[model samples]
Target: MSLVSAVQVRCPSCNTPFTAQMHRAIDATKEPRLKELLIQGRFNLAQCPQCGVQSALSAPFIYHDASKSLFYCFMPMNMGGSAIQQQQQIGQLTNQFVSSLPPEERKGYMLQPKLYLTMQSLIDDILAADGITKEHIEAIKQRAALLQDIAQSQSVEELERKVKESQDKIDDLFFQTLDDYIAQAQEENDLETAQGLSALRDEISLLTRPEGEIAQQAKQLAAEREEMLDKVINERDQERLRTLISEGRPLMDYSFFLALADRIETAQASGNEIEARRLTKLRDTVLAMIDEQDEAARQSLMQAAEFLRTVIREQNPEQYLRENADRIDDAFFAVLNANIIEAQRRKDENAMKALAAIGTVAASILEEKAPPEVRLLNRVMRTEPEQRRALLQEERALLDDRFVALVDQMISQLPEENADLAGELRQLRDMAIDVRAQG
Candidate 1:
């Protein structure tokens, strides 16, 4: 797709104006993101800030898949033009696109460009490039459509019924749809929607699985350890699980091996050689499942440490931190905090200053996002008389009884020579009274 500039878009839900970045032509061979977005059916999805609503931009775009030896122009029907009418435009775009390719890379198929009037048709064509048959695509689409019905169901009974009837539809597409929404909500900091969708995903999981399978699996493990099954599988915190540690309970992950270790000890202590042998085999089976995850976590921490150092050296620490805030979870902080401790231990002044800048950025973001009234009040209380007057004038919406009273008290206590401050407070008081009266 051509690199289209940002355009102003009004949110349909809230009527709030926002800027949307859109492209009219996409070349997958050049920009991988365009391919990924088209595949996910989110090429032109514009998310609104005022209300968490996603809307698609109606625009013509060309999809160039060099890998598939295909170039198709998707001209939106809403533009009041058929594919034939836009062939010249598409031809020019295709010509420009192919000219940029190397001689060996050019092929004959690229000469005869395909045309699709609808976005959906273009997406289906793209999916076909992967060797997926039409029947498979339709089948997946059928399942994908059921997700809306499932979302609309009012009660758990209705959801459960839909889930039971549409078992065939609960495939990869269904899960992927939920996963994309979850990811979008998290990226946007829409925690309520993210949490709601997460709970729905859990419910869907419970519904789709065979009845009593969860219960049966729970029964397979030890009874006390039974409560810890969800904790381990879901990576949930199980604070009281009995494990290898004598002082405190272990994490769900370490607890599995620790519990197994405990079981081995008990078997030896009780002289149950046969049971101990079986338990060791079971422990080995469990170990196989968790080994990869443990290794990955260790590797991720090392990568995070290196990344933190790189950020300090080569990037704006605040900008990097802000852009990657979501990725900086507990593990990231653990790595960062460890470095801070090392810096302190070694009395490394420059290193400490650099690390401290990271903390300052986080603090500034938190301060900027504080509630409007709280921030206004703090500024009003601390600023000089002239500054306070300007602050009051700027924050007319925050001029309430408490604020007015505070300003009035300040005016009464100010020195006689402070006529400007007192005059400003009186004017503010009048504005507050007017606002309250209207309210």
Candidate 2:
């Protein structure tokens, strides 16, 4: 069960008081989405409605994973509770959690809960349980640190010096780390940093080119280019040829241009001047098409960003959210996220903050405006077990037998592999019945 309760909390930004849902216990076997959010570091994220301030809610939380048999209690070091008191609280919480599970489901591991001094340690352990070693994670972190250092370098001499010292570490992981930083910088609206990292990426790519494979690889590439073009033009394989224009299909690869150049040569060699001219014209058209597409995408992203900026810059952003409730979804978030990164790259702090605020405000409105069924279901899931009976009875008008039957039918349709959902549905049905009885 997910142990959560509503709380009155003041926004850190504008000191605005608001009602927010706070989770005490997250169960992987019950509310899987919470578990996913936890892994994504988005669990307990709250946004202030008045000021649009978004931040993670730092508090004690019990994280339970049945499959991994990992039941850990995370107590934020800032809590400042006595060790003995914290231990007692953990013991009591552990007892309550174990009792909530069926006897058959309760394992010996529940007898003693593992205590993490910090949230980071808890996250590290969770990743470790999934077979990701701490060393590998650390190495990736080092790469990220180095990437930032390179991006923040004052001059090419400094960058070159640093590269000389850490050249061996500039592998795939290093570039990936650099890319991640670029995205992060964009999200924060740090433009200068993004551009700097991008430049560093290109510099590294050039510096790290294989010292001796160029000539041989060039010949190999030329052969591949001619062969592919032979299939596309001579064999007239339209399907194969169409791949060149496909999005993210490496349209900018040197071999792709080589293939077009080859087509021109072949046409001229065959003494077909018209055909040679046509191929040359086609290459120009393809280049133009690529440029046009790139420019169009950039404009679209900027447009979306500007719209978000307008919404956030408003005195009452909630009005905008209410107006465009349907548009504030995953795709919208994605566009906003990309623009945020771009904003950060541009060193646009105001835009970054505005983007963040827009997300928080939009999310709050969307949640508040969710369908009655979704709202009721979430309430039922987050409510205390003891209070659930009364809640169901109170909401019995909406949660009629038809609703229970629908959920019951939903459970029946699940495959045997989805045993967790089946158990959760059963629990929901029983709770609804119990609540209906209270009425």
Identify the candidate with maximal TM-score. 1
Candidate 1 least-lDDT 10 residues: 241-250
lDDT of 2 by residue, 248-313 (tens): 334255557776787799889999999999778767766776667556545555556556667767
TM-score of predicted structure 1: 0.47
lDDT of 1 at 125: 78
> For model 1, which pairs clash?
1-25, 1-26, 1-27, 2-25
At residue 183, give the lDDT of candidate 2.
76
Q: What is the lDDT of residue 37 in candidate 1?
A: 71
Across 1-439, the per-residue lDDT of candidate 1 in tens digits comes to: 3556698999999999999998867877666556767876888789898897999998766677776778787777777766575776777767876776778877888787787877778778787787878897776677567776888889868987898898877877789767766655543434456657877887798667776886774455445464554344333233332222222122334445677688778888999998788667656644553454445556666667666766787657788777766656555665666666545543456677888777667555655666665566556656775565556666777777666676677788997799987786687567556755664
> TM-scores of all models?
0.47, 0.40
How big is the positional error of residue 439 in model 1, measured in Å on the Cα after superposition? 82
